[model samples]
Target chain A: MNNKKKIMEDLIHGIFLILGLITVGCVFLITVYLIISGVPAIRKIGIINFLFGTKWASTAQDPKYGILPFILTSIYGTAGAIILGVPVGFFTAVYLSKVAPSKMRQIVSFIVNMLAGIPSVVYGLVGMMVLVPGIRKLFNIPDGASLFAAIIVLSIMILPSIISVSMTALDAVPRDYEDASLALGANEIETYFRVSVPAARSGIAAAVVLGVGRAIGEAMAVMMVSGNAAKMPSLFQSVRFLTTAVASEMSYSAGLQRQALFSIALVLFLFIMLINATLNFFMKKGDVH
Target chain B: MKRSLYKGAMKTLMYISVGITCILAFSLIGYVLYRGIPGLSISFLTQKPSYLKGTIGILPDILNTLYVIIASLLIVLPLGVGAAVYLTEYASNKKIVGIIEYAAETLSGIPSIIYGLVGMLFFCQFLGFRTSLIAGALTLVIMNLPTIMRTTEESLKTVPNSYREGAFGLGAGKWRVIRTVVLPGCVDGVVTGCILTVGRIIGESAALLFTAGFAHSVHGFIDGLSSSGSTLTVALYVYAKEQGEFQVAFSIATILLILAFIINLAAVGVSNYYRKKRTV
Candidate 1:
């Protein structure tokens, strides 16, 4: 009986070890695969031009790979989203963290979690149906789906994440700062921006970086709205993101062309790695308490 | 008076944004309910997606999704728990565990779309799996592994050391104590992780795009494995794009969202039950 038990325990232990190794191995293989396929494409495209060029076309013969245009659209969309989303989201966090009555805060907090739970594709669906038409009729953009649409949808999608994190950060601010400022006779808004905001700057910065990461890697939602144009992005004009570039074309694309699409994936992976790492670093740095 | 006016303006902006957010949620739900419910007669979910497009139903797509989740969970759940057991129970070195923890965290940050690319190269073309349900299922297992491992680890850690010591007093082996005591205590947590894993897989699109192709409907276990299957989310996207039939897209979106919302509530319900059980 003891011998049988011993065998079972050994089997379980081996199982645990194997599972751990597979998790490690998957991450290891993905990095290796990205680098292996990416290096040659990077060499061919040249680092500087690939980052700076504006058009992407890969065909039977010659291929042109310039990600600058897509990179530009990603930046502009993220920036626009931040501009639109941050003030609202940050204030919403403030409402939840500091200002709202307890009942309201509890309800709002749950709602925020629900929003966070929503799939990004649903966000894209709402954007297409509601935001797209609103932009067209309200703003009168020629195309309903544009960088503008992507920005609006991305901002909303990112809001719950930003608010949830920023709220925690704000909550972490020593209560003494608010109490002291109020004791010295400052208004709520005044104390918040002057004292509380400064204290939570690092945390808020982390939130913004997270939002940027969300924007850059956002594919399906943005893909549905961004119009997938390979050209330079205008707010009203359509654009393509590096993440969407491959997903949009992967179906029909073949040959070296397929390899070229994989190359696009390589570029996107590297870009996300840089952003995601920086976000992690800042999040850790913000962990003062 | 001016200050009051300013306050009013700010209140308006606040209400508008919140209202819009609410409307966005409701509008999608409303549209989907309006179109899909009317369309989801028994016939719709029972038959294959007709290439005839507008008249196609998602019976096979639904079944394939169920198959993918079942297969993927079977592969992921035990392995995931084991990894968690080792990390939380066996490993004492904080630094070594920290590396794996951080790697898992970073992996979660990588977009699902990138996971699709890796799956394409590793599972589909390289391994010669072709675009099948298994291909998508395996990819999702990878996509969800980190989350499951982390959640399970947290659950295991929540099991008090007193239980282990009690078993030790009885001359039970370490592994026996873990299997008998800790595993039962952490069952709810493991279940939460699995439920969440299902949520992630069910709603995922980009990862499934290449691995699972975009057929409106496919049926049969063998056909689902060998043929094209589009998930609820992908179907929403396809209908929203090519069809522009907002009614159909809305209906599908409603189904996906409500399904997600329900599963989430189920996870929370489980967590609450566990919390209560633990207190007792």
Candidate 2:
């Protein structure tokens, strides 16, 4: 009986150990798979032409595979989203964390969480139906689905991450920091801006990084609203994103076109890894403080 | 006078920001429901689309969504819970724990599109699962693993060390102690994690778009898992973007919205109950 019990315990231990390593195994598989599949196209296309070539016509008699347009559109779109989203999110976080009454805070926070819970495709649908047409009429552009529309949609999509994260960071600020600032005769607003914001800077930075990640990774929303044209990004011009480049063509792409799509996904993976590193740095810095 | 002016300007800016945020959320919810509810019907819920009859329904998509959820959850909950158990109760080395945690974080940070690409390559091509609901569920299993692991790990941490000691004091084996004490204690976390994972799986589109090919047909759960089909989100995308069927898309969106609201409420309810129980 003792031996049987001991063996059973060992079997359970082994099963749990395998389960624990499953996450590591998954990460390893993704990395290995991406690298294996993503490298062949990069090798064939020449890295410079692949990364910096200005035109993309995969189906033409003589196809050109330059993805600079997709790269630039992604960067500019994410930047526009950050520029528009951060201030609103930052001030709202400050208000929610410091100034709002509890009942008001609860209601507002619930709304924000629901906003987070809303599916991205719905955002895309609304953007397509509303924002695209609004921008077309407002700017009197011939086409509604332009890079500008994508930027606006992405900015809204990223708001929840910025607000919730910044709220947590601001809420964690030592109350004494604000009390000290206020005791120096600074106003409540001044105390929050000067004392609380600076105290929670690392967390806020992490929030910004998280928002950037979300905006950059967002595919379906941008794909739906951004007219799927591979052009150099201008505010009023239709553009393709790295994500959309992969998604739009994967269904019908063949041979080198398909391989190049994998390369685009690899490039996207690298960008996300870079963002994750920066986020980790900020998160660790916040923990230390 | 200068400081008073500064304070007034700052407060005004903050209020405007809050107002904009609220307006954005309310308008989104209000607009989706307004456009969606009028189109929702019993036929929409129960019948499959029929081009021959000039009618459209999302019964297949709904069933597909349910299949994917059930399939993914049945697989993920065990693996996630087991991993969390090992991390919290069994893992002795801090280095191993750090590595496992970092892997989970990295997995969470990966974008869904890349998961789609990799899942297509790995599961569909390599494993020969092909483009099917099982493949999609497996992809989502990876995507949701980090969430479940984190939540379960957190609750396991809350299970007091003394309880484990008491189990051991009663002459229980390690597995016996965990079965009796630790697993039962973290039921709240598992429930919360399950809810959150369901929300994510429901919201997921890009990842499923490729791994699960966008064919809308109702099948039994076992059959559905083996065949290619569109989940609700993917169907929404197909109807809205590819087919240009706004009414169908809106109706699906409304159903998804209702599901998301319920999931969020349940999450909050579970957490609140856990908090109240803890304090007591």
Candidate 3:
């Protein structure tokens, strides 16, 4: 009976250990699969032309599989969103974490959670109808769907992440730091900006990186608002992102077209991995402080 | 004078920022509800679309969404909770813990569209699941694993060491201590994780688009798993984008919005209840 009990315990431990390792297994599986499938097309297309080519006419009789347009558009769009979203999110985080009364903070935080919970598709729908048309009328453009509209929608989508993450970081700032700043003759506003914000800088940096990840990885919303044209990115032009590039062509694509889409996905995966490393670095630094 | 000016400008900027956020949130919710609610009706929820009848419905989509949610949660809950339990209760090596935690973070950071692509490659083509609800559910199981593990691990940390020590002192085996004391204690975390997972599953579309092709035929759970179907979000995308049926899309969006609202509320309520229970 004692031997049976010990064996059962050992078996259960083995099972739990397997379960614990499943996430690692999954990451390995994805990386291997992406590389296996994504490498062939790149080998055929040549790395420089595939990554740096400025045109993407995959379906034409003579296809040009240049993805420079998508790459530049993704970079420009994410940068624009960060520029538009971070300050508002930062100020809002400061307000919520340090300035707002408790009840007000609770209400606002709930609203922020609601914002986060809203589906990306719904945001796409709203942007397509409202922001797209508004842009057209305001800017007197021929078409409403442009990189600018995508940037606006992305900025809104990333706000919840930036605000919530920054709030957590700001809230984690030691109360003693703020008290000392106040004791040294700093006012409340100055103390929060100088002391609390600086103390939570790493965390805030992580939050920004998180926002960057979300914006760059986004597909459906950006696809809808950004006009899905394979053009070099200008603020007012219809442009494609690396994400939308993969999504828009996947349905009816065949042969090299389909393989190239997989290659685009491979590029996106690499970008996300880079961002994830940066986020981890910031978070680790935050923990150290 | 300069200090006062700086203070006033900073305070003003903060208020303006708060104002912008609130306006964005209210307008989004208000606009979705305003446009979506007017198109919702009993038949729209109860029936599926018929090309012959010149009518549209989302009954099949609703059922598909339910099926995907149930299947993904059923598979993911065990894997996630088990992993969390091992990390918290069993793992002695800090390096292993760090690796697993890093993997979980990487998983969460990955975008859903890539999951869609990989899921298509792995489950649909490689594994021969085809474009079906089961494949989508499996893909989502991967997507939500980190969320469940993180929440469960957090609550497991709150389960005091003394409870486990006391159970061990009673001559209970390791598994028995966990089964009796640890698992039961983290019900709130599991519940919160479930709610969040449901919300994510509901919101998910890009990942499911290819892994589960957008077909609207209704079937029982067993059949549904193997057949192609669109969840509510995918159906919304199809209607709005492919079909130009904004009215139908709006109605589905309303249902999704209401569902999202409830899930968010439930998450907050469950966490608050657990926090109070622990204190008391």
Q: Residue A43 error for model 3, in Å? A: 0.4
What tens digits encode model 3's per-residue C-alpha lDDT throughout B1-280?
A: 9999999999999999999999999998899889999988899999989999999989999999999999999999999999999999999999999999999999999999999999999999999999999999999999999999999999999999999999999999999999999999888889999999999999999999999999999899999999999999999899988888888888888999899889988988998998889899
> Can you give the lDDT of residue A220 in candidate 2?
98
TM-scores of the candidates are: 0.89, 0.98, 0.99
lDDT score of residue A198 within candidate 1: 83
Lowest summed lDDT window (length 10), candidate 2 chain A: A109-118
The order by descending TM-score is 3, 2, 1
- Model 2 chain B: lowest-lDDT 10 consecutive positions: B1-10
- Cα-based lDDT at residue A65, candidate 3: 89
Best by TM-score: 3
lDDT by residue (A15-80, candidate 2, tens digit) is: 999999999999999999988888898999999999999999999999899999999999999999
Runs of candidate 3 with Cα error greater than 4 angstroms are none
Q: Which residue pairs clash within candidate 1?
A: B32-B250, B32-B251
DockQ of 1: 0.45
Chain B TM-score, candidates in order: 0.87, 0.98, 0.98
What's the CA error at residue A260 for candidate 3, in Å?
A: 0.7
Clashing pairs in 3: none
Against the unseen true structure, what C-alpha lDDT does each candidate score?
0.78, 0.94, 0.95
Q: Interface RMSD for every prediction, one decimal?
A: 3.0, 1.0, 0.7
Could you report the DockQ of all the candidates, in the order they appear?
0.45, 0.81, 0.88
Q: Which prediction has more favorable lDDT, 1 or 3?
A: 3
